[model samples]
Target: MTTARTLAVPAPAPDAAVKYFGAELGFEVDPDDLVRDLEAGRTDGYAVVETRAPEAFARARIPGAINLPYRDLTPESTAHLDKTLVYVCYCESTQCNAATKGALKLAELGFQVKRLSGGITAWIAAGYPTEGDKAPGIRCAC
Candidate 1:
């Protein structure tokens, strides 16, 4: 009998799994959940941030997302953001890391932060609305 590689490591205990999954939920928000919140106008406690270049953001982005490129996330630039609201950061897609970088910067700066799971790719794939010069549902080249 051969042990499958998938079972090389046993799964965590149910209690530990619960804690692990629950903690992951706190760090990421699904695109569908975000759209539901936006559609319902329940976004007062959180702000969407696009962690891409200004040109990329202008080409296509979440309807209410503020462009704050990860490379430019600084105390001076982020001062205008509301500290009370959790900032949800996203980049081109799961293929990109700008969102993670931005989230880390925000957290280091003492602000609440979460990453938009799968980023804009998942958002468009879900048929969520976006505002930009490009048409909605258009895949980003990135």
Candidate 2:
């Protein structure tokens, strides 16, 4: 019996985060590639920011992820932050606008941030981790 849950085409050299620099005040990241690296513990100097609320972070999250809800971002947020060049912002899903909003806000603050192309939903759909899916989203009371 043939299983329909396999990639028809074998991926070569693993997926790489595709940088879309020409976008309006932002860029997109290939979540598939990001998840691969994270799972393999091959992630480099990039910073993965979960735009989830603190309560959500307390519940669960991707290991090594920094919790910074979209509402907390400001010109001062990047201060004393790591020297990481790439900042990936992700929320609940592609249907959620928090990541994009946060990414744009970070860009305005002069941070090189990118939205996790399609967000965590895409990552989970790609068979990635859902360690934090149990944590519901926070819509920023601010």
Candidate 3:
């Protein structure tokens, strides 16, 4: 019998992380890029979808983003949507997986999908505008 040998592997660099689009998960849109597209109306048949709950969406959402909570997505519900448009799904923040779930659902329904990197929180942090009645309004702490 031949002796078995083991090989040691070194860890990746501290900075080695998926900064932009992740290859394994396909394309991902950075917050700035998405904002540019939205501002310039250069979507090119792309749809930015908010995958969070209605309440979250109603409170605030990226300008022009349509609300389509992940839990309510289905063939029937999505029938009216253009299948050719690339669907970019986003949720609360990087910590939220709702966007990923929405992307997968859209992809299954034959729509090209890209997850929005960093989600809505990142968008707000980037100083992009949001649309909705419940969006942050004038506040006073007198």
Candidate 2 lDDT by residue in tens digits, 1-142: 7646676655444233233234533467687667778878887767888886777665555567787788888767768676456778887676678777777777777777877866655665676655544655433321
The top-ranked prediction according to TM-score is 1
| Superior candidate under lDDT, 2 versus 3 | 3
Pairs with backbone N, CA or C atoms under 3 Å apart (clashes), candidate 2: none
Candidate 3 Cα outliers beyond 4 Å, as residue runs? 1-26, 134-142
Query: CA shift at 29, candidate 1, in angstroms?
Result: 0.3
What's the TM for model 3? 0.77
Kindly give the stretch of ten consecutive residues in candidate 3 with the minimal lDDT sum. Answer: 133-142
> Rank by TM-score, descending?
1, 3, 2
Which tens-of-lDDT digit does each residue in 14-101 have in candidate 3? 5554633246446787898878777788978788899888878878888888988888889999999998789888998877888888
Give each model a TM-score.
Answer: 0.92, 0.67, 0.77
Comparing 1 and 3 by TM-score, which wins?
A: 1
After TM-score superposition, the amount by which residue 110's alpha carbon in candidate 3 deviates from its true location, in angstroms, is 1.3
- What is the Å distance of residue 63 in model 1 from its true position? 0.5
Query: 10-106, model 1: which lDDT tens digit per residue?
Result: 9999999999999999999999899999999998899999988888888889998999888887999889988999999998888788899999999
How far does residue 65 in candidate 2 sit from its true spot (Å)?
1.5
Quick one: RMSD of model 2?
8.8
Give per-residue lDDT, candidate 2, residue 131.
57
